[model samples]
Target chain A: MSILSLTAVELGRKIKAKEVSVSEAVEAVLAQIETYDKEYNCYISVDREGARTRARKVQKLIDSGELTGQLAGVPMAVKDNICTKGLLTTCGSKILESFVPTYSAQAVLNLENAGAVIIGKTNMDEFAMGSTTETSAFGVTKNPWNTQHVPGGSSGGSCAAVAADECFFALGSDTGGSIRQPASFCGVTGLKPTYGTVSRYGLVAYASSLDQIGPVAKDVTDCAAVLEAIASYDPKDSTSIKRDDYDFALALTEDVKGLRIGIPKDYFTDGLDQNVRAAVQSAARLLEENGAFVEEFDLSLVQYAIPAYYVIASAEAGSNLARFDGVKYAYRSKDSKGLHEMYKKTRSEGFGEEVRRRIMLGSFVLSSGYYDAYYLKALRTRKLIKNEFDKAFEKYDVILAPAAPTTAPRLGESLIDPVKMYLSDIYTVAVNLAGLPAMSVPCGVDLKGLPIGVQLIADCFKEKNIIRAGYSIEQAVSREKCEAARAAESKATEARN
Target chain B: MADIITDEMIDYVSILAKLELTPAEKEQAKNDMAKMLDYVDMLNELDTSGTEPMYHVFPVSNVFREDVVVNGDDSEGMLKNAPERKDNFYKVPRTVD
Candidate 1:
């Protein structure tokens, strides 16, 4: 039964051995979705028949001993922002509620080519603007651990699907901590690949420079497997990094024997929640015990990351989202008389408040007289932040920090002040601004029994180092006692039942 | 930074972006836009002398490719997605009407 609890690699081995047929495993996932999705709000839609059909094809291939694809029969889900052919790629917004993509995203194409079965598109922050997926025009996705708390966002749904066993792995887009923050809250491993590492062809543009499609899975190896499947250049997206240039997954081994991890002195400041701090410190100690050096490095430039990230991401978001005018592919205002009215009514009524807020902020910063004052300056400051990271990597193999300042907060706690919600992505956003690769792995749990994640940020195109360090922690934490601690509270419930 | 970005400025941006905003919403935007801009202006205090501005983190050159007929000619797929399409093109409102 631990095959249900195994890594994607282990599961793939079982499938290849025909010990577990693809259809049986997929049906079990579907059954789990049916049983638990109501509690977590993890899925926007579940393609039961389509998943069964896909699973049957995979099963047939396995029966013929023709399992050539690396991820044959693996079940994966995608964030709704990805353009899966014929699927409603709504980006969790009302505007494109009826719009479906005619073409698949290159990343999705790669996954399908490798025989990964996509079950459905997961929910997200509308247009990937907000930190909490509560910004979705559709309902908010609840944290699988505690329904009352948020799973973090905007990749909350993807992270939850994997954490709650709705799917083995899910593809999520990280514009600004969308993937890692949610993964942290949901007790999963999520990777934000270096900016160009993953193709952004059909990501429904949200701050294009910051956006990247990454993997969320139960652990680091699955994250690496999903990353390997999706990471490649496409002619369609100019920003896509060619795999020939950087074979990031090729360097995955337990070789962090002498690798140094920088713990930014600024990160462990006065206000970091004591439990989250303790959890990360404990993880650092564990890594130290495992024969790696953890030393404090000063990234003074990171203090400005939040402000710089907002200026740059919002400005780019304003430009990218401008294409969503009613005249184009999405939902148009029906009753409008002219072009102007149509554009106004369509976007005004169509966009969620968070989307509108970003667009408005984006517009304001890039507007006349303020262009040189805001947008241009932020671009310059972004370089400084990247320089800090680039310089730090010269000294340290990877940078270690808390995935989030704290564990998942109660759903409505920070939703009121939109500014405060943006602050939640503080630690993870700078990695986006710098376009670095980072992974969040479940290192430890707090006193409250909530899972805590430690972030390992590697240099650009050096995802192997990320997984190298992350996997060490993953293996150390995979022991019987460590694993038991995760399920102990649940075992108590079983005792009561 | 002004306490208010004028309706005229919003109109200017809308024109540049090919988007449109309403008068009442424009008034609301004028207020909201000001707060957002002021937040951005907070960065003006930082000193960035001798910094090389970079748009992308990866040092990729302009990825110009030879323009060829790599058309997405999946007509049935395209037409199937359109709310209203006729004869392979998207159906639109008449310009004069």
Candidate 2:
């Protein structure tokens, strides 16, 4: 197998043991990108020459007997919204088409410090606003599994890159399921850490309170390893939670005996596709077989999660995005009557339709007369949802649900229907609302062969619980695939005899 | 409950958001905004009379740091991304004019 096919953890071990040079591994990934990224469109910018230089430096350190961090020499990709000094960090928006940051995001720095060579910046929804990457000004990123379908958005490029094996791992920012949903669509493992666990210092703000940086990788183990490398408290981020050491990779054990898992009834109702429902149901049963005590429960407040999420997210996005007013570092309008005209023209011309709609909605909700009715009401509803999760966690160690209502939609299916696009985030948004940790693990594939994922959510800072359960499900699914393959082989031999 | 978004409301919000929407875009915005507001109006069913709104997830108050400069000014690096700059300052259209 090509070195690119090895998981980040496996590649790290090989690099440490001198089995593979860092430059060789980086070359394998760059070769994969050259081979497949034209069709997948998973990257916005591939740092071909820069990554090769970084890999050589890492190889030198290893040669000198210097101890590097875990993930040494692993090739990685970061979502475009996260700043990488001297690299283009457009949030898939035309406004920042030429904007390059002078500094890297705290998470990107953490990954680099741990010896991960960043191969490229991945594509995302414009301003991380849409559920599908179709809204990206660059172009839509197609799902690797089915090019006719979308790789779920905002973090679509990051997830698709991992799915396509373009990179060993990728960093993705989640706000209302951006990370987990795309991970589901692309059949990769993604984790949206508990709010404040990961620093947001250099991540482009979308919905400040809801946005979080996390990992997208080939499997649960790789996800855990990347999370350990990036999750840290940085003083630069006011919301970053100060912490002691957290070893996420050490938390991955496939033992779930007597673990309490809650299945929220709300997640399985009305809009869920039958195949997704069956896959998630079987995932829950698989957990039960592993000695996890699973039961159904009511989280009625989840019904309000979508409405509240849109209101809060758009409101913050409106405020956060106000900085791009044809001033300082963004696109400036050439034809402008005055300063006011320049501001208006620049924004209208630069922002896409969905971004404009969100800014308008955000302005309306926070408008003087409507503040109490929309913004404030959503905040209260958010509190209620958090309380419900708090109550549920008292009884259950983790919650299991579908990552998305359906598999990846056709490339442009959700784009035309704005409300329909928002509904795609129904199953995963509540975790962000409640400020909890959640992950999407590949459970099975739908009838169309598109992948399905089941979400495992845990209370604040309890990522270990979900990682453990996700590891169990991952193991069970792999075992079943082995058995089925062996059965097919034996049947073929018998028929030939 | 009726179509709350109107041409006047769209114009008002466009100005507030500093966006110059064309007449065609304004019409589309009116319709899209009306639909989205109607959907978000689902929150009105719940009575949150006594509930306190949560602005931030963690209960943090006035985070204080040491009175020292951790990162020095990077004026040169900051100017690298400026679309139009003169020396160390950003150049904008004449405001007083």
Candidate 3:
């Protein structure tokens, strides 16, 4: 296979064994980006010189035997929201279009320390305020599966880059399904680790309580390996957690024996597309055949997740985004007479329609009369959702559901009606609200040729359960493909005879 | 609650959000906010009477450390991207009338 076609771990192994040099790998990916990125719009910025420079340094370290990790000398992309010292980190917003960080995000720093070469920054929704990348000041990233459709947002560019082989792997942030939903749409693997497992030090905050940095890659193993490399505790971020185990890759044993998987009956109700529902259900059945005990259960309060998620996320987004006041490291209006005018004009001109709406909603909810009615009510409902997940986990090791309600929607289909877009995040948002780890693995392709994702969720810090289940599901899917191909070949031979 | 998203409400919230919206944007905001609030009113269906509000996912309280600086300051790097700067400080519009 071509170097660009190899998974991140496969490429890493090749680089470590001298089968492929780090520079050669970096050059291959840059070449791929040069050819296809304009069509896909998967990147906000591609650091060609930076990637080449880092590749040379990483190759030197590899030769000297100083850096020997699985990801050492591997080239990767970063979502724009995660800071890269000199790269423009716009968070897909015009407010900070020219802003560059003086330091890297803790997760990016961790990967760099492990000898991973930074390629560039990917595109995202403006302040992560929208489900589709259409809200970005920059243009939307097209789904690699079909250019007419969206590569879900706000980590759409990261997932698209991985799917299109523009990067070996990419880092993305999840604050209510940004990573997993896009990963699903792009037919790649993405993991949203339990909140606080990955430090959010330099991540452009959307919702401080919900944001997390995770990996998007070609397969479950690459996702696990990338997660293992970046998951770290940092004193810099007060919410960062010190965990006992960070060996996420070791969970890829492809063993689902006696695994208890719960299929939430609520996820299969109205609004879920029949094809997407069947794809997830069949994946669960495959696991059951592999000795996993799968059962349907009532995961109530599901209907409340969307309303609560939007309220809490918008409220926190409004608070977190208040720092962009046209003073420090952001665009300032030229036609402002006074300080308050400067703030108002800069924000009004800089932010997009979706961002403005969310901020306005946030202000209204947190205003005097509605704080208890909306924001507090959402928070209380959030606690109830977490309690439901906790109750479900007591009887199940992992929860299986569809990553998105349907396959990737055609571009312009979702943006017109914002509430319809929010409803698409139904399956993935509750995982974030409960602060749990979830992985989206491509299970099957729909009749329209778009891929469907099966989400594997585990309770906080129990990443191994979901990772193991995800790996097994991937294995079973690949085996089924092989058997189908073999039968087709035999049928062809019989026809020839 | 039906007509809660009035022009007055949008104007008040826009000021609170520090956004100077045009008349068209204000009208659009009124309609959108009304729809969103109508949808968000669904949360009222659930009676969360005794549940404590979860401000954060974890039970983390005050995270304190010894009062020591870990890294030296690079004022130049920090100010490099400032929209307007003068003598190691961000320059903003005149606040004093």
Candidate 4:
């Protein structure tokens, strides 16, 4: 068997049984990158020598019967926003393009302790602000399945690399659907663990309240294993919760007979593409067939979630990014006669258009005159949205909805109309607003043949249910299903050619 | 809904946050402030009577633990990245002097 094409769990077993040497595994993955990276652009930087060195060391340990932990020598990619001590973490923004962190993020630190080898940092939306990866300061990440269409953002590069078999799994931070949206676009499994379930110590803060790191992988089991490695409280992150719940991987089961899945009626609104709606309904029926009861539930409050999220995220982003002045670190303006011109010129030149727009919007809302009206009221409505989900969860084990309103739109399709593009994150943003755990698993494909993902949300700290149902309902039993879902992606590429 | 975060208010906020904004930033911020306030008017119509405002949505609160040092003061590499420094302290322009 070509173990190179296997999921992370299978590869772990092979490495444990001595069927695959760590060097062989690492060499094979590295060779694949050497062969296909130029075509996929899934990787922003390749740590070829570093990864090989780590792999050899792990192989020596395994040969000496000293192999320990669940993920020893598992090669993985990480989104750029999550800091790597020695690597450049641009977070897809030019303001910090030259900034390299001195401290690794808690999640990355945990993965390293478990013997995971970091290969490179992936690309993303500028400060994770866009629905598509087109906004990246680094070149846009193309979907591996079809290079013409974008891989989703802000975790698009991570998802693309996984889908293209560049790594066993990748870590992605989700705030306003950055991880899962890209996973769906790439036809991969991405989980956004419960907020604060994973440490935020190394994350370049986009919106502190909403940012949480999670995993994207080829299957649900791999997702669970990666999550287990990284999910823990860090002394560095005061918001992280120290929980006894260390057995997330052990809880993945097919026994979802008593599971109650909620289907939100509002998610199937007029603008939702017919194919996406059908795929979700079909997946729900499959769950019902597996002895899981499916009930339609109300999510009227989710309608307000996107608007509320924009205000809150923009407000927080405005504050967080304000630290990027010319004095502290990063790019500074030249020929400045005064300190004021220095900061203004630097920010104006360093930040992208979208980042500037958000920063301004954020500053506006947080300004003294408007705080009571915008930021305060958005928080109040944010409470209402969370309350509505809390009420729905009381009746259901999981809430299922389309991850986005449609399949990946053409790269430039929504560039002219920012609102229409923002609406694409309409379904996924509420999970962030509510601070709940959610995931995107491949459901099916649209008529155009781009992958369509359906999301499942659960209450905080109840992330097990989200993955359990996701694993149960995953329809990609064959690689052909993945290829079919990615058909539109390649066709777009051919059209461009 | 005037974008009325004045130059003095902007300076005060920057000081509070330990950020330094420039003069052009102050003028741009003033205009941006007004636009944002104009947009905030959209929320004024929503009836939120008796609705208890939520600061966080998580069910668990009071999650902070007592401060306990876990590791060493590893500043060898941290100081390398600092733009300006003298002795062990970050060097800055003098205000008092």
Kept native contacts, as fractions per model, are 0.36, 0.77, 0.91, 0.21
Model 2 lDDT per residue over A1-497, tens place: 77877999999999999999999998898999999999999999999999999999988887787746669999999999999999999999999998889889999998888889999999999999988898899999999999999999889999999999999999999999999999999999999999999999999999999999999999999999989889998888899997666887767888899999999997888889999999999999999999999999998877789999999999999999999988777688896878888888889999999999999999999998899999999999999999999999999999999999999999778988899899999988988988899999999999999999999999999999999999999999999999999999999999999
- DockQ of candidate 4 relative to the true structure: 0.29
Model 3's TM-score against the true structure: 0.99
**How does chain B of model 3 score on TM-score?**
0.94
By TM-score rank, best first, the candidates go 3, 2, 1, 4
User: What would the per-residue lDDT of candidate 1 be over residues A251-286, giving only the tens digit for each residue?
Assistant: 566556787988998998875889999878877777
The clash tally of candidate 3 reads 0
Each model's C-alpha lDDT? 0.82, 0.92, 0.92, 0.79
Chain B TM (all candidates): 0.74, 0.92, 0.94, 0.64
Instruction: Considering the true interface contacts (CA pairs under 8 Å between chains A and B), give the fraction that model 4 also has.
Output: 0.21
Q: Count the backbone clashes (under 3 Å) in each candidate.
A: 0, 0, 0, 3
- Would you list the clashing residue pairs of candidate 3? none
* Tens-digit lDDT string for candidate 4 (A1-497): 77569888788778878788777777778887888778777776778888888888887776677767667867889898998988877788777777778789999999888878888888888888887777888787788777778887888889988988888899998999998888888999999988888999989899998999999999888999999999997767767877768688765776579999999998888988898899888878767877888999778765677768888998899889877776656666667566565666667777776677677767656777667777888889888888788899899989999888887777666666555677788889989988898989888877777898889899988888987788778743334467866897899899999
In Å, residue A14's CA in model 1 sits off its true spot by 0.5
Off by over 4 Å in 2: none
Pairs in clash, predicted candidate 4: A146-A489, A340-B22, B3-B34
DockQ of 3: 0.89
Worst 10 residues of 2 chain A by lDDT: A61-70
